[model samples]
Target: MVLSSPTWRERFRAGTVIPAHPLALTEQRKLDERHQRALTRYYLAAGAGGVAVGVHTTQFEIRDPRIGLYEPVLALAAEELRASDAIRVAGVCGNTAQAAREAQIARDLKYHAALLNLVALADSSIAEVVAHVRAIGEIMPIIGFYLQPAVGGQYFPVEFWRAFAEIESVIGIKIAPFNRYATQDVLRGVAESGRSHEIALYTGNDDHIVLDLLSGYHFSGCDLQIRGGLLGHWSVWTSCAVELHRQVRQAVESGKLVDPKWLLRNAEVTDMNAALFDVGHHFHGCIAGINEVLRRQGLLAGRWCLNPAEDLSGGQAQELDRVIATYPHLVDDQFVKQNLDTWLS
Candidate 1:
């Protein structure tokens, strides 16, 4: 029986288009409780309908060394969200057992769903991957993930996505293959699954945000539309991202074509993403760049990360500075500054 209310699809339709979650850290390379809570408040105040933690943006610090911040950080987010209407989505990765344990932690902490990352199954057959997802479905409601190869990508045939969608507990999918074909593969899988309405598709593709949101995917049987984003890119310039997302959502939901200026805005978001994600360095500095945004706003003392290899790349700051100066409308730094103190207090 379905135990969740409003379901994941309903939540997406109700203006949760931009979930402005951020990577978690302080300059000390640890969970910054004050900053963590501040980030949560900032997302809500900035118009995010929900928040996600424990995903890639949060760093693998929680588990890579067993630093034990997973539950604490998730618990902190849960506390901050308790009084609000925003739903909480906690990310779960690893093998079936590990994923289940992590998911249980999220459920026990009162998260609404799990962002299921089905990776490290490269050697496993499509059938095996489908089985793994089904096993996890028994543990909690799932949001399927299609991560890019640059970041521990996983591959399952289009058929696997079709089978996975038929699972009663799966609610959404975050497609970020960074490949249009593979992205289309998943979309086609859902369209063919005969359960299109049951599963929501969210774009994690930082490179193709506007088109993903604005362009409806047509299949022989059914049409699939990307609901919105569950992206690391949104971690920066959050308030403006929230507004931009809402505007896009209104147009798409109303079946209207947005102006060219709106489409052009995506290039700006991508520009900011390039600097924040450190695309120049193959995204090695992604986490650090996100922390840098917070650091400038006083949320973090430095751009520290769990993996030094993933730390800020040389010249990334110069690139970020250039983007910030040239593309003022692309960031919400001022909004963050205006509410920083209130959030911290």
Candidate 2:
């Protein structure tokens, strides 16, 4: 009996951070329906009920089956995220029968969640990846891609997360493992699964997300899912990954502050995005650095369909614009040069 949402736990017990209002808009950004319901009430008052602004089927679908318009790229990724009120349009199941038919395209296209990437079934078993996440959680809310803990790269056995934390629509577990003692035994079977906040253990491990959030040991009370798993040196390491995830979640909720002057001003773009996790599909070099910054801000058209990610030529786009010119507040060379002709027309 552990499942609650009392208006997102009364805005996280009133500490607040809700954000999720962008529901795919158009009619010429001429937003009006009461300004899209006051931009989803300022995206649920900025952070939207706990938080979830997704997009990580490794660069939103390109595993190649001759990329036929999957319903116009899922309605242009849900109309470029409903022209941004905050963002929410995720449905990249891609396998295990398109993650059970994208859970009926996330409940008939009212998507707010469904991001399972069993990294192409990391060579099966963990009861066939918990029977393909109990057939995509019977239809939505599943987030289990323990990233890569098995399949020629094994070691994630806490009895395979005690059969993946007893399933009940497996709320979370995004490890990005290869080491860390099988993600510290899948965080001790998610705190002996009495169902910690129903479940959540997120951490795509970007170069040890601020020393694994200052070693509160494996996700001490988890909740951290950074988007576009930063592949190669994303414009000089996405402004040192937005101030090292805002100084490690503000030193885990205001323990004063600890600054490395923005991690030594983008320490060589976080050592070239921690040097592509030492070769060979280190999260597909953060999905080829978020598809070469969405194909240099044309919102992508091409960049070699997720093989060994190729395309950013001319000396790797001038060394990714010299580590994205040492973070001008996370990329603003004139908003990628005036939205590069309205996103590469």
Candidate 3:
């Protein structure tokens, strides 16, 4: 089903933090249903607008037949989301047939939209990729993803984004190329698509979240803003991320000169992400790092990933400790502490 309700569309356009929900796995690398439900509760309690499940942060391996977690995970989140008006997004990946099947699953589960990952179409031409996207859009409302090359993402120039945005079912785009120039290309493409007003822009750039929210883009006579975030960085310390989004929205809506402090805080947040994402090791520990934070807060049982080899990098723990101590205000330990039991229940 598409986003047919004006209220739902308005809520999405109004902009709020939408965390890339993480998988809570047991020490045996199995899904911990209790902790998983608690995570959905935690994001809602922390004031997130919604959660994106089955995404990279949720572990792409969930789609593996041996594991068979894709449907169960999405169903769990959809069940929790039913009681609230919060937007529900499911991550859809793979080629035309595979992505369409995933989109159908998300649609069957009542997800409002599918965040389409095009990594599987990397070898296809731009036309073929757009065809694949259009095929998925036929099954569900689409949110385009420009994932970073450091992961499985492939580069698509301005023309490709313009065409992608032009698709009738496309409602949003997450610009997370993790490069300034690449991010700008998406802004330019969407602006030029003449459907800029129809599509909501979200920052997936973990390293540049604050500035992306605070800044605006002018291209081809159209002005645009990064309306919100669909971030893995937001999976942890989400209360703080929600507050930061609110502060940025207030500053931008005020239309006055932005305080220099916000700009300075941008650097601080980047430093924090460096540790959380393990930029030192090219983000090898990114998922584990996020899990580590939640584990420390008692939100997660442990930092176990489906892949046995995935764990925190050397000194990554030290870095996390330093950031936690240095940036006390950036975390929500107190918030998590107050309601951890309630969420777990």
Candidate 4:
């Protein structure tokens, strides 16, 4: 569906009532265009909040770079994400085995896009990455990543980024490393260039989105691909939390809902997600938590994934239950319910 965030002009176009259905995705190209437009508006709109969807690569493996494809399990995850309006879904792959599969998964599943990293590809050279991008571009949208080694040993040079961004199919960039200067430099370059509007600089700096946005320093930097507002546990928490924030922020800005009132309602749910970050082995725990939350609300069968098994343990699930009990508002139950109705009908 063509899901444009309801802006003031959009609201005026919408008039008194907002249609339940946004737009039809009769053709795949239209769907792609809609996703691109949505990404642009969400990042550039004043106070707009955008989210990058997360996926695990344990289930999928990209054995060869020439032909982009993944295992069946990865395909399943991508399929589920494609059906959701929560946010843009990208393969959050690990090591070399699965890294090659990300671009393939993005294409095979018809996913809106994916976040590419060294671990995801296992080949860090700009030349290799450029070739990978060229091949993947024929498949789906690719969001380039530059992460610090300590933050997961994912790093790509500024020159590499400049080269990658030069590609038309490359839609966005996620700056994951904590180095503020480098992020600023890259953003400054993007802004100075004529293509600022077409590309996005996503703040991978989880703790600093608000600071960067409010700062007088303006560059092509826009949007956030984070775990809500919580950054402690990144892998699993980033996209989900960011999704909640985007939905809450959009509702308030659209005048379809009031702030602080429903705003508190959204946070109440996000708090449960935030609490997951504090749990041990938070990366795995957080992904486990997402499925736990989903299963509790009957969204999924259970939390399941392949090796380095990031799935939550039984005890963590118990803790998640406790958190949910204390804060029932954390589930986005109403939104879930509405979608369920549509799906079942």
Candidate 5:
């Protein structure tokens, strides 16, 4: 079941906020089913266009045979998305064989596409990597991921992206290399591929959300824009993220000079991400930081992760507190407060 329908393609291309769904764990490090469901409901209520489950924010350890959570988490989110026309993306990693199995699972659950993480093939050549991607594309539509190297991602040059864009099943690319030059390489490659119009561009660069959405790239005679975001930073204060995305989209579509205030807000949003993503500690506490905010908002019970050693880095909580206190306009605590009960129920 390929998600090649014009309606789905048009909606994805139009751009919308897609939160990288985080895992909700019990105090014992077990899956918190109720809170898990609530998180999906919260994303939908907060006006997210979609939720990306089994992704980095959900914790890669979920695929561990001992933990066995990959399917259940994807299923929970799928259940919630059934009533909506929201795009469903399941994060699939590993080599071709493992990724194929994962893609089959997501396909069975009705996911619209696979956000293919290539970290597992760090040592493989670009040609080998493309082969892996092609194998999985046979099972479902693909959304190529360019995860930042700071977190298990490998560097791929413009050639790799050009080949990736050429894949017939690829419908989008999430550019999150976190470096301006690398981001441009992706834009150039996709533009050079001549398939830019067919592949939607999404900013996974949490640190540069506003500017990415607001900026346009002209390469190989093709003008490219980041249509939306698929971010972990978005999972916490989602209602505000939705509004921010709307404003950015409007500015981009209008093709006029953006107000200076939007540029200022970009730095503010980056600062917020720095705190929540544990930038000071090399992102050692990134996942916990996201959970900490949700915990404070009552959306999560605690900041527990699958690995016991994974918890907030020292001063990370202080940073989160500082950002939350300083950026009341960027948080959705009040929004969550109003509908927490319904979501929890």
Candidate 6:
């Protein structure tokens, strides 16, 4: 039973808490195939609507010439998720040829779409970026990304997104511009392009996940809203993230919106993200912090990143410890621990 691109977009809007996957590694920094399967199985059982690999959470380590982990990681995840009903999105970056090749590889491996991270071509003009996206669209549908600058975010204009939205191959977007103004700009373009319904809007806004999901926008005579989340923060405590999405979706369906209890929970999640991301350290500690939680659950052996220097910041471990202690229920470590052996098997 193969799923088409549109089926994948429907899943994206249907509360698919697509957490960007962190590459699992052995202590020796080699790809851990066992852990990779474990992570995919965990997300599937946890009810993640989809899973994204080769993204920021997976680290740029895959791209390093010396390590060259890109192929193995995606291949492993694709094999693990080959039968999944959930959407499979592989991150695509670099210049047009590189991105096109990545998209081709993902298609060959049966991924449904590309989470197009146009960040690598930071200096490329709007036309160049559009050209790059158009080239990859030849291979698969694109989930356009507006990543934050702390991680080499691109400053794409509304005009650029308007053109992108008009393209038949651009089926979804992860709006992580990480700025209210920039996010609205993309929304306006989508609305104006008269393709709001065609393009699934997934928020990567970790700071405003609740608001982004619940708040409906009025732009260009079109009503627009974020469908779900594709977040790095959701990588940890995945089942809880799925539950949170269910709660939020229930709220949206109920019509009596703005429930105070859910609002508080959202803020709590943000605070936990601040700790997990190590906001004080400019998010340099984020991936390690996620792995740290997985490590404790026995899903991973260590917080080992491909880059030697990519470990946590000075107080990141302490910050993670504090967050875990403070929000014991939020971590959902018990659920993973209970199913750890099963998922590993």
Output the TM-score of candidate 1: 0.94
lDDT of 4 by residue, 1-345 (tens): 898776432222121111001111112212222322332222222122323333222222223333222433334343434433333335545544344455565556555566665565655576876777766666666666666554354555556666777777776666556577777656654554445555655545433533332233454454321212212222222233445455643553464434455545434544554455323454445544654554454334444432235557557767776775786543445544444433323
Candidate 1 vs candidate 4: the lDDT winner is: 1
**Selected candidate, larger lDDT, 2 vs 4:** 2
> Estimated TM-score per prediction?
0.94, 0.29, 0.98, 0.54, 0.98, 0.96
**lDDT of each structure?**
0.81, 0.46, 0.93, 0.45, 0.94, 0.86
Candidate 4 at 180: error in angstroms? Answer: 5.1
Residue pairs clashing in model 4 are 53-88, 99-120, 149-153, 226-238, 227-238, 228-241, 228-242, 269-330
Clashing pairs in 6: none
For 26-123, candidate 1 gives per-residue lDDT tens digits of 55567777878888888889877788889888876677655777788888989999988787889898888888889999999888889988775778
Worst 10 residues of 6 by lDDT: 6-15
Query: What does the lDDT read for residue 325 in candidate 5?
Result: 93
lDDT score, candidate 5: 0.94
- Estimate, for each residue in 86-121, the C-alpha lDDT of model 6 and write its tens digit: 889999888888898889889998899999988778
For residues 75-153, what per-residue lDDT tens digits would candidate 3 score against the true structure?
A: 9999988998888999999878888889999999999999999998888998998888888888999999999999889
Whole-model alpha-carbon lDDT for candidate 1: 0.81
The 10 consecutive residues of candidate 1 with the worst lDDT sum are: 13-22
Which runs of model 1 end up more than 4 angstroms from their true locations?
1-9, 13-15, 18-20
Residues forming the 10-long window of minimal summed lDDT in candidate 3: 1-10
Candidate 2 residue lDDT tens string, 1-345: 999645422322222222211222223322123323332332233223322323342234333456433343444444434544332434345567866765675456555446565666656777887888788777766655555542223455787775777788776555556467776777777666656456555555544544544444435465432222211222222333444445556665665655565455435434444433323343334444444544454333333433333333334444455555644555534544443443323
| Candidate 3, superposed: residue stretches over 4 Å from native | 1-6
Cα lDDT tens digits, model 5, 249-325, are: 88777878889989999999999999999999999999999999999989899999999988999999999989989
> How many collisions per candidate?
0, 13, 0, 8, 0, 0
